[model samples]
Target chain A: MSETGVIHDIGYQRYTGPRLGRGAGIGALYVHGLRAAFGLGRSAKAKIFPWLVASVALLVAVIVAAIKSQFSEFTFSYVDLDDQLSWMIIFFVAILAPTLVSRDLRSNTLPLYFSRPLRAADYVAAKFLAMVTAVWLLLGVPQFIMFLGAAFTTKTGFKGVWHEIQDLVPAWGYSLLWALLFTSIGLLIASLTGKQAFAAGGIVAVFLMTTPVVAVLAQLPSTTANHLAGLTSPITLINGVGSWALDGSIGFDIGRYGPIYAIEAFCLIVACLLLLLARYRKVSAL
Target chain B: MNIIATQALTKTYGGGVTALSDLTVQVEAGVIGLVGANGAGKSTFIKIMLGLIAPSSGSVRVFDIDPVTETDKVRARVGYMPENDCLPPDVSAAEFVTHLGRISGLPRTAARERASETLRHVGLYEERYRQIGGYSTGMKQRVKLAQALVHDPDLLLLDEPTNGLDPAGRDAMLALIHRIGAEFGISVVVCSHLLGEVERICDSLIAIQGGRLLRADRISSMTTASDVLAVEVSDGADELAVRLTEMGLAVTRDHRMLLVPMDSDDAYDRILRAVTELELHLHRLDQRRHRVAELFTAKETVDV
Candidate 1:
């Protein structure tokens, strides 16, 4: 053995690089939340539920595209696709909203996050934006498939594809409305609990349980109540807004209450978002 | 420069329970220990330092930045390991720490590199890729520490870093903390209820009781040698104690050893002469110093 062996200095090194500010923190959180919603960078078990719903949505889009190509007279527009897949969208939100918000609560990781440069508003905003984008992709991607199906079959050249683009853009907006409303409400419900099961169940219950109230309210022997009953449920509320603003009706009539539906949709989204921000103003004591 | 300074910091919840009452202290950069019992506002003090919760009244500054107004600026330079299970079970330690590093403002590649380096520094090398749920309490604590260090903050606020560890694990953790402070040149404030652990690793001590500052001083000053000599004999300790009392010195027997009060400069000579006259084999003789635990019990006795 050598008598003069030297000891290497492997001490902790200080990072002298540029440290980004709050914007970078929020952006990283947004990226992480979005990946988590789709179970990216997680175990195979985590990917099962998200991909199950996503695959089903993709399968339906393929079937719709095939059907539209086969039947030249088929009038199933891109907006109609979102209307038909509303239940899938609800299921997607139930699965996704909890994964985005409740996991942090369940694991009690908010303190670790808050102890950094990220603020509560930044946290809430990143999560909300992530869920919105996830839901929009779930709906918007399928609508694009339907457009592709129509555009390929059209013999009317570029103008036909341009027409398809026009229809697809409005349908994407309609899907965005669905994304915004469902995400805000679902995230608000999910944020209230740390247990993912309870949050998922509560979110599904809120969305499913309200549709019956709209049905019952529409039957009150008053035309005014029937026109205003869509406000009672988020599902019908979106349909009412779609029918009034996008001129896409899916068996729901808002009558002259188009502006009311628009205002209620807008107000409901704003209120849910505000409530989420308030809920996160202080993380759980743990 | 003082890393943390607080003046009349009071935090009263809505239920009228005061967590911190008029706490005023300034801590310099070193391995400082914050020692207190459960519910003694140690956690509350740390949270206020991190700006996690606002103080009900008064002012608090971390790194000379007001935590309440410039929370982000304060938090940017402070790494905190909370006193709870904050690790997500499903993710590996490497991924989780890297993610937190990114949130703490490191770019993507730097976060990954720092996460690996930190995990290795915390004595977690091959196990960094394993899921944290399968880790032992010691390994989990290492993961938590790794995340806190991955950001390379100027100061560290660790709350009960060795809370659920065995004796050997505790020793390893204390050694790591000591190295982190002494070698890494980063200031640390270790909040713990165990005074022995704090005294073993800290340069200064801050003791709190019932949301009040009991004492704040350097460990050296707090543990200065008391006017007592601890002597151990191979045998005949009882006779030695009796012989010491026969002289002017007061002696107290503690099991096999005798504690003699050093009242004069000749105390050691008197002890040596007593041992020689009694023909007892002197095994060990040393000055008895104050322990950090004495501060708490001493205050209790004064209160009574």
Candidate 2:
């Protein structure tokens, strides 16, 4: 035996166990992306913004509930939950969409992801779903807390709770729609650049710039062109969808536009989805 | 069986620069070194084999599964350590490696278990919890390597694994790579432009130049000893060479050694007698073996 070439057993064990396939791989990315969206499993500084926004949003809900409990004759309900917190939702997503998607691209870690047992479509779907779920939680938690508060504090107690449940169900449904709408547009814009600040700024600009333009256009005698212009802003579309999904009404008088505005909003949603898919598809190749 | 095989693989980018052209090769299961200089198409070939990119006109197979068509299957069975730094700086090595292990289809508990084991094997156990942004370059490379091994894939494609390491770090990494292949029996293809390190660590070699296959063979065959014997003397190598030449032996003088053609049965006796007559102390004597640098010119004479 040669003294120099004797190989030492370094405990490099071969894995002979069961290995999951593509579905499990995609699930792992989904879970990892979900944690990243809220800045979990990262630096302490990374955890600050998302948690702060969540706390502030929840505090607002608590304060609102506290104020509502004072007046027994108050008829305030949960249907307007999204309206009160839409700006907060916008801010949360502006910070979060880039946190989930742009960091991977900016660090050029897509190749690390794509080189695994994951497909390009699966990766995009995982990121999109994570962002949607994040936005849902960001919006849903406060709504849920407020729902419990309103249910128990009412004068009629369980009866008021039963009545509030009826309204809360559709409000929950509207919040989900809000999640899908905001995440789709936010992730689509965030995927355009690898720079996180740029992606965040761009998302904020897209939301901030178009709202006034939509408001100005919606005032032009409620014309067909004006109603169509309302779909240009993602927030207006979210509001239109929320009103339609919750109260069966359309914002910016879009109902007179004969489903054209809704169709355009749906088309815009589809376009954002397709753009996100295409962008990650290109990244997977890199 | 060949773990990876490519048939006339070619790739051309948008700017009409050909990264690889007419490349055909087969790699067996062992520590195979890809020896080449920069821009020699080593990375392109690796990316193609990993199913990360498609060839312009050819096919590739990893363990007889086509990488282009069966990417998930191929990638599931293969681990890749890329040439570039591709780590998220905010995450610790433990979290990153475990997440990648799960992404490669290991169950969560097994992923975590294997992550620690792999990180320990890569000598990063002590600092696995530190954020990668604060890690030194060597630590970051080990993190990248740890992630690749966390899944325990059948094959590992390491592109420039020693790209930015100091000499000691490079030595430790090469030793770890050597042990991984020797002890665990996982096949490794270590891509490097340094001939000496590759020669030290790899069992087989594939040399390419200008995106073309220059030579592929067992490291032993490529480095077989030549017919010349190198003789080193303590005091006077020049005097030994002159005396050996005067004694009708074909000898040439190198810096501190004399090269003599060992042809006849009495060659050793003749050289010994000449050195004895000169009363010179012999330092060393051995047959001259070919080095990997000889492959550059050896290909011109031998058909690969």
Candidate 3:
């Protein structure tokens, strides 16, 4: 402004165009969350951890397939693949869940999210779905590689390939279940704190630390006590349920305790989802 | 039409802390500054207006819709820049601002296009691709502003946007905000405890104290000039004051200046004559304008 108070024209055009509504807002958030989970649209360094874990899983599957192809007489199936790669899934969840939940909280960015045309439930739902998708990719892609590898290396020709393809039906179901369950529990834990180290460490402690304790507890003489002990580690609970569902011999003996493990796993999943909802509800209220 | 209106809006948090108490005011579309001291409920008022928090009682209407009930509607047309650092470190300014635009309901292509335009307008075109963690404080502030603008909101709720900038950066940010209001015609409600900058850029002000509305009026009315002219001389200010008094002009000494009542026909001429007669170097002679600080003090005493 000059001494005479004449305002100059600095061009800042008003937006007179069409603006999208609430559904588009929710959809955008879902896309952004999924991108952030895999470190897409971020720095190259930010992409390292997720890609490294994914690469390691892929490499293991390839190496396993190579060894199986070389030794044509050895027996292998997708159930055995899931058993062998269970720890990798646990590790993937521990490291990646924090990226989806903790970073936003740590930066106090909830106001930014809430200030948009989105409800708290929408924010939580989008994040949860993105997390499930990320975990599914991590766990499912390797199993897909294993399926393809198994079909090609089969000496029994089309019969062997058909059998392997049939086995993938159960494999994909189990992989999706693992994704849903781990996403719920991991996101619930990660939502508790903004500190990534603490969230990640806590997730690791819950998944890894409970394994040995559950093992010792399962050695009890009583059958009921052994079935109850399987409820401690998510890995064990999932394994127990898988054994019951598939009637396979991978981890625990189903015997009469199969239904008990399945019920406990279902309850745990529901509890984790409920806890996640409650945590986000409190944050939005504030 | 009023851009925002509150009817007996109050917010009382847990443990009996009242952040806002019965703040009822109407704000029109323009550069409106929300000024108050720290912990004076400025943030609380903003959150309620944005529908980020519910009021304990009463109602808030943004763009003529109840924020509590139609929060999504209100938020769809409003963009908010919070008082703290909220950008994720791992993302670049381009990505973060584009993501915010998407979150605000822009399509992917529109978000990307607007993100670049907004970043350029905020003078961050050169560093748009740099990670935000590497940005300076001024750059970070610009990034925050850019995100708020990327959505092309009808109104902007800026909570202490200039909190951490140096004088130069503060000047640039205030200028950008001023243009946003004046040129773009976006209704801006800038929350700041810094009264000077608010006074400089805002057309009207909503001043608060102790969780209550102190006053809301045009900046011109609040800062109307008093009937006094200040005279500053390089030397002999006391002599000048005495000489002015002798010349039948009521004068008072203030630091190195003489405050003469402009009750006469020629206040400026009288001061110039006195300075010329005394042969003292006249540094300045200007009318004593009322400031926002004086307005605040005046309102505080009036409330008492």
Candidate 4:
């Protein structure tokens, strides 16, 4: 600019400063990756999660009171045996993951991820794992305390949380196991679409909305419905936890110790792998 | 040798919307400009090279590595500043860069040191400790660039780095890009649609339209340099140009000026003789050089 402030920058030069090497660069990117991934997750929690989690918690609290009332002796069907908490988890996954992942992709904020040393798979892993931790903190902690209390009160075989874990190893393990499954599934669905609403709604429609109708419609006199309330295969662990909490015996129909855990593990792993592959495809396209 | 190369890298999304197609190009060193109109596939081609998007049926390589097969490795060598303002609004620039430096495998002390140096380089040292949410557009842009460079990549890919900046900010950013290539020894791919701006900085330029490579050449070489001269006259301009043309000098009339392609002292003397004979008052006579702006007209014929 001249003295009068009439700007003239014709001889301008670009930056030529030294930077990090490749090996060290990737490490820098990881730092960027974690902050970015967790930052988005935290923002989502602040914006959207309160309503879903609080509403569900309120419903569960009401049910807790209702069940302790005159309905104590009444026996509902196996379908009503659980309070659709698994479905609630599924709902949260469907809505939350898409809003978090897909919307960013659709709007072409991809450079936000790629510019750092962050890998596509690492981004996927961070998002998926963070979701798992989030669900565990929000859902598992509350449900786990209630489980230990219920187990001790019933005096079936355990005394406290520690005793309950030893006596009812099947319950807590399955609870965390389901948390992993739902988190992975949510991320997988979100990875495919570019819009949050579409991904979340698609998850709801496929696993929760249509899967249940299909299972129910598929049920017949000689034919048994495979899933109850479309509990994402991993949700059986929640059923396992609910079963142990209400009753003293934690083991189930599959076997004395082997519930549908292998199925849950298998699904969770497959979901994670699939999401990674999809993330790779997306990254390559960028 | 070209550090980044693309062979007809095409991308057609669902519903037949083509983001990029047949975009064959090459980039060697220095500050290269990628200029196009909005939705003109500058981002698409960059994404392909970054391995962030897969071309429909083509390929891209960066630093002797297939961006697809060696994405992690490729990303290691490439730093990117996106077009959009997308920092996590709550994080400090220093915090963000240090985190990325760690991810790029920097030791704790080095990451912190590198973050400070980068923020300083981008002139954001005062605001580096502040959250990005409160930063002005230019400060935010510097933070974006700081993260890209904190890792010390070999190439920097900046998408519309000057977007939303006032004149001063754009000039500062452009100067930084040039310096990165020349002083930092880092090749840069700076994307912009403003020909006047990129022409001033980029050593080379590539124009894209309708997902296709429209043109690629050095900004210094694209115009196929002619011996054209810009001549302005204070009086009798029209008569002077006519006299020069009649004198067998290829004189062309341009707005408020005349273009004379004189080759020898004799040819120059002939034009001077014509001007003197016509009694025209000459204001200035300057050589015309090749510039990216000169070929913007050619960019119109291709699809975006």
Q: What is the interface RMSD of each candidate, in Å?
A: 1.4, 1.1, 1.5, 5.7
C-alpha lDDT of residue B297 in model 1: 90
Enumerate residue pairs that collide in model 2. Answer: none
Model 4, range B172-236, lDDT digits (tens) per residue? 98998888788778899999988788877889988886677778888767755455777888978
Least accurate stretch of 10 residues (summed lDDT) in model 1 chain B? Answer: B219-228
Model 4: lDDT of residue B28? 85
Error at A130, model 1, angstroms = 0.4
Candidate 3 Cα outliers beyond 4 Å, as residue runs: A1-10, A63-73, A150-162, B225-228, B243-250, B261-265
Model 1, range B1-304, lDDT digits (tens) per residue? 9888999999998899988999999888899999888999999999888888889998999889998899889888999998899999999999999999999989999999999999999999999999999999999999999999998988999999999899999999999999999999989999999998889899888989889888888887776656579999999988888888889778888888888877787999999999999888999999876567876698779977
Encode model 3's per-residue lDDT on A38-103: one tens digit a residue: 788766776888888889878877877787788867667666766677777777788778888899
Q: Weakest 10 consecutive residues, lDDT, candidate 4 chain A?
A: A74-83
CAPRI tier for the interface of model 2 = medium
Evaluated with TM-score, which candidate comes out highest?
1
Q: Pick the candidate with the highest lDDT.
A: 1
Q: Is the docking of candidate 4 incorrect, acceptable, medium or high quality?
A: incorrect
Q: What is the lDDT of residue B123 in candidate 1?
A: 94
Better of 3 and 4 by DockQ: 3
Q: Please list the residue runs of candidate 4 whose C-alpha ends up more than 4 Å from where it truly belongs after superposition.
A: A1-108, A115-119, A134-172, A185-237, A241-286, B5-26, B36-41, B53-60, B134-140, B164-168, B207-215, B222-229, B233-235, B239-250, B261-287, B290-304
Per residue, candidate 3 scores C-alpha lDDT tens digits across B1-304 of 9998999989999889998999899988899999989999999998898777899998889999988888888888888898999888877899888888888888889888889888888889769998899999999999988888888889999999998899999999999999889887788999999998888999999988889889998888876655578888888998898889888998888788788878866878878988999999999888776568886887689877
Q: Which ten residues in a row are the worst by lDDT in model 1 chain A?
A: A277-286
Would candidate 1 be rated incorrect, acceptable, medium or high by CAPRI criteria?
A: medium
